[model samples]
Target chain A: MSRKLSYREAMREAMHEALANDPRVFLMGEDVGRYGGTYAFSKGFLDEFGPERIRDTPLSELGFVGAAIGAALGGMRPIVEVMTVNFSLLALDQIVNTAAALRHMSGGQFSVPLVIRMATGAGRQLAAQHSHSLEGWYAHIPGIKVLAPATIEDARGMLAPALADPDPVVIFEHAGLFNIEGDLPDDWSADIRSARVRRQGKDVAIITHGGSLPKALAAAQTLAEQGIEAEVLDLRVLRPLDSESIAAAVAKCRRVVVVDEGWRSGSLAAEVMARIMESAFYELDAPVVRVCSEEVPIPYAKHLEDAALPQPEKIVAAVKEMMG
Target chain B: MTDHHAAAPPSGPVPWDKAFALRLLTDMLRIRRMEEKSAELYGAGKIRGFLHLYIGEEATAVGALHALAPDDNIVATYREHGHALVRGMEMGSIMAEMYGKHEGCARGHGGSMHLFDARTRLYGGNAIVGGGLPLAVGLALASKMQHEQRITACFFGDGAVAEGAFHESLNLAALWKLPVLFCCENNLYGMGTALERSESQTDLCAKAASYNMPALRADGMDIVAVHEASKQALRTLRESAGPVFVEYQTYRFRAHSMFDAELYRQKAEIEEWKTRGPIHTFTARLKAEGKLTEEEFLAIDAAANEEVAAAVAFAEAGTWEPVDDLLKDVMTPPPPAPRPGGGDAGSPPAAAPCEG
Candidate 1:
């Protein structure tokens, strides 16, 4: 039976389960072993899985990620945790050029069943270098599947399906959602396709994902208090977006607000808005609005940090404006 | 090192009867001819994109590929026309791929630098330096995990050795004891940057040895030597533990690609290497050994020319993929599902995050 757990605990449980079930599955990253995860997601895994499986690597992202890709190619299920999205830039080539493109390039003869998990999004006031969301960049690639596990259930269940998938899958764990706790159903399984409706409303639809899901939901609650019911959609799979669900929500609500943690320009939110315009424009009663993070480097100061990101107030304001 | 003698008696000198040798010669000649035609085609603006000719590199691919079994996997770089031809991919399909026809090996999706034939287990004609190494490692890993008696041979130029992927792949192959043959073709130049200028340690075997894997070097210009060395190395890899690295000291007589201006090295250096060209040197050796005659060489050459003519015709007649299916194969379409959230319009489910 599934029980209530925090996003951190759910992710830890998934890793623990994978290590216990598969002899080939292992964890490797900068602090995935003795130091637990950098976010303490795998706090007690080192003692459970031992150093061999729960390996701690040097501060060489390219070396270790390439090694992980190698290890995956070599018959092991390597879950490489690249401490933060900012640092994953060092290993970008291996992920983009090698891991993702190998399968189709091989004429479907080879598949890299590798899973890479990295912390993304900004809410902790960690300055410019640390606070960027680049999951959309990965989603732009063709061969790999990109997943953002926004909830506890997704954190617990996504790893299994990801490991089972025959292609490389990149999982982005929002830095802001680790402590958020929720009830897990007795039979819970999170599919890596389609969007999950977080809140039901008919007046306006609030579409978002990753770290922004919580803020969107909070704004939906605030909107509910003001008697403006907002439908909240959590986009779990970023690459092959569940456009049907999104289109359905837009058709019903007729007004939409996209809440994205990424910058406004060339954002995933932009893609969603474009899709809406292309498919559901005639059904829309008002123009779709977007509440994206300010088009600037996420600042370190508390006030500036709040100002840089999409907040519940911003979502509330966007939804109210859309309702009008 | 103790010589682990062959378990089987050399497959009777590798079945290199007159017919087989002629076939080998014909195969190498076909690659040479097709590439020559491709160069002409590139000049005429019929074949666009980077066209890396496998002119002088033919014998290395023909020799080394002949040593491998059909079940074994092959991963090669952009300059892989020879490897693709010798690995049993249909000549017509590869030619069609070069022409970017829909009937090509990769169905026109991948061009000259990305020829792929899954039926022959030719993984790719990868353009990215060192990109195919990790893929080869993974294929070998799958074979090992599945308890299949298969090896993956990855071919890249010396330039790929300088890539981090090369070192990482070497270490993983050694650590996991995967059956991989890392074939490095040291053609001396990574597109105008000579190996001496790019690499700090010129001895590539020394670098591979750092991973505790056995490494060998061969005269790539000599087809017999390459064949013998690769056969021995494959035997060692198959019978023993872990991966092996083979450095084939080769030279490319043609420009790096069709676009090269031929300004990188001196004309004298080119003439010097051409003296040891694989075809001329091997044909001379075979004639000296009385294994082949001048008339037999001509017969093989005529047969290769005939095959190339037929392949060109086949490519010319190939079809293009319909524009309607341009977005196919991006993702496997998902199965139909019942609409979630109580078939739509059910009160927005209380801002709940997805459950595990």
Candidate 2:
């Protein structure tokens, strides 16, 4: 049996289940408790779980995030919520220098079993400070796992396994997809390792993840109408990218268009393109193209923001150009 | 501040019993001997990278470590040879680590700046100025939540006082009332920058007190003072299950690192501070109190020198970790292969390098 659920509801249900199942699991971040989460994901959680579990922290990103790492070291599973990717920069030292490096530095004596979830990507005219996808920057690190849950099933199911993993895992929840609805099957489960084929086709592979997944799917629909079949691949895991799945898609389609919400230069799209060149260069039917955000701070103006982001029309245009 | 002299020569009677007092003196002697040999090895090119010696700060580490239980957590700075030694990390492992050998504490991965020992619950030799504070706070948070009778003692230099991490970590620990003992080793200088030059408020305990935690100060060059202050702080932390901060007023007797030119401070100031060297002053006091004799002091010094020589031999015999295992321990290894019959299915492949 399957039921319709929004991404926000599914994620909420997932967190509720995690908290209920494990006494060691607790959520701590700015506005996570009494304020019901900055995005309202934890609405009414404080009432049910009380102050001890659903902790509301001050705007001390470096302090709280580092503390979460310490707690994880002290034998507790901790999930930290950074309100947005932009603010996570304040805590980057803990994430990169400490959490990521601890296991290797300690000669395999310690592993930080921590999950950090943050809102990423641009869409709601939140302006420069609130928008911008830096998941790629995090993906560039060596010791952590990066996940972008694009669908309801993933938003609901990724948290459990992420908590189960022994190393630090970072999940990017696209701010734009919270209200989007989809039918989540009762057996929905997710693995935090590989890319998933959202829509399979043969003409072109539209490779993307996070907020760009829906845009690539929409472009695939438009391409289907034009008698061209496009394969949509969601790069669910970014750090340890699923090169096998990416190569499989490229081998099948022979042409690729990478859609990323981050800027074009040194972007996730660039990484995906590099991987295609490295792994499946012989399978290329055409030069791999990318549809990424314009190289500018995401602005508040709606039209300008739309122009800067990777939209359905942009993905469609890139794929069409490749097909031609 | 430069205005302050060598702290009136740490005047006090030796209060501990003869055996306990001698043990403290012996630990201090061990650190001094080991680090002096480390300096020679660095000059000889056996120990490479930045070697930050904890020469003058021995009293702080020896005193504070003896005050805490073996199970309590310790997070320390890059100049952590003394802390690791007092915390029970073998002297040979510390020397081997500095040699970048696999037998070292961190398997040659973490050199002088990142010594970590799980057996002693010593979290790290965190190189960043204020990096270890948050980890200490977090460990304290875990202890409190799990109702464990353990506290986390985090040590950083006076330079870390200027870092935002210092302010933020203190606030978080105090706000949650976590069992953390923030040990600020005020060695008067952070790298080359003097404390007054770096901070507007020169009093470190004032800053910690501003975060609503009780803060204390001790004569860092005097092991008895540091040990007594630490004991008092730990007692309060355990009783209240809250954070406490202690400022150990001390000085570094050597250059910040092997590469340091030390152009910032004057020769007279270093010489003046050396008069109150923790080892000699404590030995003199013990002699005056009839707890230690000249023969006993010479014997202890000789023993420490012997241990350092043996440690160097151990380091010279240590092997290098192969480049083939470079990526090992970067992430946890995958779970043991699934049961034979049923066969584990749907397990994500272990994270391997993209280049491979």
Candidate 3:
């Protein structure tokens, strides 16, 4: 039997593998060292990698991320971790302005080979401040590549390629999916580009990424029994949008439903739908629908939070509505 | 401490030899002439965007940069035309960048505010208030991890002391014992806001020392002081495990930019600072010591003018980048495609562009 690993363990394994393989690759972030990471991702890494390799940073996201970019320029492959996507706003200027613009601004003289990993999405009753689906905002940027690793394979495989990439790459690890365990084949490597068809169907396409991917899968299963075959397309790479795969899914299914944790207003789902409209409009059987979190700030209560997020039932409803 | 501003006129015999003295003098002159022409170009609409001139602040860059090796990394602020020139960046590329030309450094994508060159290790001409501090920390971290003896010199205005990045970077660098030279160019103002008005505690050295860092203050107007202070910091960085902070007490002669109407300060104050102008006083001391004659000074000035003219002509001839190639280099040429059907699904291609 293939060994099963949780999404969090897959990420930790990938980081550990990168560190053990490449001397240049070091992990730096708040609480990543002695504290064992805010989410316990870097547990026992400090002793293995030592204090130098496993750096614990102060609550200075802007400083550390910028330093990570500089280190990348100075010829070290750095993997920077921000506690969550909500706190990443503090370092957005460095990510967008410095990391993204450095290579082109330097006229190809420099490339920031830096990887930034941050937990994202709303679940576990973390409330508004701790949880936010800001991956959509990051995906809007052009210079940096954005990744949403939903599956255990993706969580395990994406880090190596991201660290291997010359340009700055931001990986969004949905907080909700961290504990979800799945089977991982021995060879668990993947590319940082293109969407993957987790479940193939011709009747409808359930397009989504990150925390919403599981919900999308469950919804697909529900739609399968109802005689509506829905293809579950995981948008692995969000920035470039894996337009080819998105178009392929839309063309095959002819009906589309975008499930995202972000709100409907100008979300990544909106951008995906717009691309589908532009490229696969003629093939569409019905208007593309979106099942997104409510526009209000996510409340702490479980029922309110669940009601606000994209549930499996919600994805099923959106897919059914799109098919109709 | 009365602002020494070229105190006591060089004592007796000249300190630096003729060749070395002339090189330092010529560097300041080059910055002065380039920026003077840049101001004219700005008026002619040849160079747009914010042009922060380093007219009087030449000594700080000229002296400090000369103290470091060619391979050392430099992270500077927007008013960095002088730093770029002193670090051996071509004047033509700097001028061409201001012109937004394809042949320019950074290929004209970043205007006056953003100047970068990978070959020279000039990290950037960072414009954000305290943006370069964190970058310098990172560069030093890389050098430390690789066991390389290179130092990362970060230059920023006193305005940066107010930023959280400055505090965090200082703490990080100090705690980690990374090799970094924190060059604080205390030019008295942060785009119209004076130091005392903005900062609660204006003593920069004390702030750096609070982080358990060894700090010093240098006369930013005096080339010798700036150079010596930088060398001291460099030695500390090379020998010691921690970072050093040096506050360059300097002033700017021109308005912050072409847009300023000189609203904040008085003309007399500007004139008083001009009395302490780095170029003329250093030239005066050189003349008194006979290391520089009137003819030699004029010749140096004339040479600077000629270089500025040549740079302007070069910028005039530079071309614009085609809009089609705009997307190139955003990512590292997307690594060459994985070969046929042989490689493992999880394995990366051999042509990985990172860690080079």
Top of the candidates by lDDT: 2
A31-112 per-residue lDDT for model 3 (tens digits): 9999999889999999999988999998999989989988887878889999988899999888988999888877887788
Candidate 3 chain A: 10-residue stretch with minimal lDDT: A185-194
Best of the two (1, 2) by lDDT: 2
lDDT of 1 by residue, B1-356 (tens): 22222212222233356666666677778888888988887887768989998788777898889899998888899999899988888889888988888878877777899987766777788888887787787677667766889888999999998998788788878877889998989899999999999999988888887888888888888776677779888877876768988888899999999879989899999999999888887677667667789998898888888888888899889988777766554433333552453112111112111110
DockQ of 3: 0.56
Which portions of model 3 miss their true places by more than 4 Å? B1-14, B340-356
lDDT of 3 at A239: 80
lDDT of 2 by residue, B1-356 (tens): 11122223235677689999999999999999999999999999999989999999899999999999999999999999999999999999999999999999999999999999888999999998899999998988888888998889999999998888998999999899898999999999989999899888998887887888888888999999889888888887777668888889999999999999999999999999999999998998889889999999999999999999999999999999999999999998776543332112232233321111
The single-chain TM-score for chain B of candidate 3 is 0.93
Grade the docking of candidate 2. acceptable
Candidate 2 per-residue lDDT over residues A29-145, each given as its tens digit: 999999999999999999999988899998999999999999989887889999999999999999999999999988887888899999999999999999989999999999999
List CA RMSD, all candidates: 6.0, 3.9, 2.6
Question: All candidates' lDDT scores?
Answer: 0.81, 0.90, 0.88
